[model samples]
Target: MTESVQQLVRYTRIQEIVGDVIRLRASGVALGDIAEVENTDGEVSIARVIGLDRNIVSLQVFTGGKGLSTDATVRFLGRPLDVVYSPNILGRIFCGSGEPIDGGPLLTTDRHVPVGGPTVNPVMRVMPSRMIETRVPMIDLFNSLVESQKIPIFSVAGEPHNELLARIGFQADADVLVFGGMGLIFDDYHFFRKSFEEHGVFGRTIMFVNQASDPLVERLLIPDMALAVAERFAVEENKRVLVLLSDMTAYADAMKEIGVAQERIPAVRGYMGDLYTQLAQRYEKACDFKGAGSVTILTVTTMPGDDVTHPVPDNTGYITEGQFYLHGGVIDPFGSLSRLKQHVIGKETREDHSQVMNTMIRFYSEAVESERKQAMAFELSPFDKKLLKYSKLFRDRFMNIRVSLGVDEALDLCWKTLAECFEPKDLLMKQHLIDKYFPDIAEKETG
Candidate 1:
């Protein structure tokens, strides 16, 4: 053997096998090191070191250990997993294992970069003051998605959160889109691909998907692979990268399953105690490089049974900047918030943007109260009838997830809805904006 190949280490004994994990006595092995396991039938599979004792290492096999013998040969790779990073990867799709599954030519191995590195330092990160306009009125006008912000779409099953995610991916003004989907059905996967293709954004998009039928371990790798590539693009290429991850709940579940397989103690709801740490390690990747571009993360976190207190979303709420609450086929403005909106609302947007957002939400809240009163058979007041009219317009124009409009257009629609519902004097807005925005209303009153 060559001198380089002679230095490789191999072990042919397996101490124990449980679920998809195998335990063996091996010295000089670090956690997260990749190992190639060749079964007795001459079939090779991948495994990663998940635990380490004094002289024993526990590896989680990528391919489940169903028929493997105890004497399967283990070859340590002395490195963690990595993904391909190059401009050629654009418009390509890869599996969670970082292999090209789109029938494309195999990429050269020279550009591989390791995944799951420490996050950018605070001093290297710039303040998130820029806005990423998705053209979704509810998000752009109300809860603006700021650059380098990490947020999630809080939803339940059967909601169109995936559609909303794809819409933002294609519509958001970013230089590149990195999408990661975990445990998605085939149809949903096809839909996203078709959406990006039809909207002409596929050329600038890179997808890392793990379907429901794929290996569960691969689900855990999607976020890391996607984010790793995104970070490279933002720093190396100096491009604004938007990363959209769907169903982070599935990723957490995969971790729990692996934890169970390893016989580790479970935390709240059968999850490992380090759930928050693992999630933060990935989410902290969102950063605006000081002299380069930015990476913005928007993920879909489904709350089981629509329970906000569920561990996954409950923990996510504390880590993310804010969440876009997707319920009842729309983004509930009351439940959704952007804590960083103050950074960009009036700075990047129009001067009237802040006042318009505040006024629209206030009237919508009153409209909701009017709806409750009407439902209770209470006699509605004259102004309550106007509020009822504003509510329907707000839903159809802004709240519906399908409604897409620029920030200025949505602000104009807000003014139009308010003007059609009430006279200029009835509007409790700043006199300057009211008169400047709708001079015809003021002129009629003065005349």
Candidate 2:
């Protein structure tokens, strides 16, 4: 590593004040040079002189004020923030500061790039018609995961959202998986790394982690770094990439902090007014680029205090195509949905897929109503009694997140479950589907 330390003499009089702002006069020849300020006590921060009036130079520090002094030495690095990018970055773990944390040697590649560039234009986007199967029953059979789809897991803390993400990372059909962890606990990060490795999928996975103890500024860079690498792989290498970001609530929190630092006006619940726009920029990055591979994003957005009405989840609901609602250790059939499922459910999957999915969910919903009626001791019809029975079976067989099945198997199971509760004629599905998939429950009943 090359070290070039240049001192800023004029910065001697600089004093770190409230709000982390600093006032300095450039008395040395290092005016306009990027400097890293450190206190005599060995705390470090990066700052750039953004304004200069006469001999006074104004520097904006990346780290918010907590420790500093007039005796702090300012060393100018003479460069802007840059990230190393290359194929060699694959299968490696990097910290939020873009440093390798996987006990590997630093990449000496000259392919350094800046993060947070503009998104691709809409005209450059191709229609997303391809499906990316994760083989998780809830996703594959019911809510189909589509290529270039940007979906979020709307969950609360202590939920198995991270485990769900790791499962998808291990099982997703994409060629590459880029995981960005923001404000994740050490245990969650370890779980993801171990899960990928144990499943023999680590070589195809790239992780950029920002733990809760890292600097706040670094947390803001993790998503961009992960997305930037994913975009490169999708465009240049023509590899289908799946980007998994855990706890986007932390990303939004970083934005809120920056907004407060910049003295911006707060919108709903003290979040910046540009929250929606900022989120859209990142979500829209999920695109099928023309003549290239696609990038799909599956993010975990934990609702604060289990409040979906909170700004983070509220804005996300509008921008994302759909969401997987993780509650009570299950992907709620009624709460979860995939808007793009209609595009490929029947067309790309088995003929009975759409019918079975819809019929099963419809029956499940009716079962809920029937259960309520039974609870109230209402006079229930024979059909209502059947629905109540079917709902219980559906919850046990399908609603459990741990239940894994392929599309065909899930559809077949759906048919068997329905047959146990309702007659074939009462299913209301198409005649062809009824003839093709209905099990021989009639023979069992007669026998």
Using TM-score, give the best candidate's number. Answer: 1
Residue pairs in clash, model 1? none
Instruction: Write candidate 2's Cα lDDT for 100-208 as tens digits.
Output: 9999988986488766678998887999898888878888888999999999999998899998999889988899999999998899999999999999999988999
Candidate 1's C-alpha runs over 4 A off are 1-8, 439-447
User: Which portions of model 2 show Cα errors greater than 4 Å?
Assistant: 1-35, 38-67, 70-80, 442-447
Residue 127 in model 2: lDDT: 90
Per candidate, the number of residue pairs that clash is 0, 0
lDDT of 1: 0.92
In terms of lDDT, the poorest run of 10 residues in model 2 is 1-10
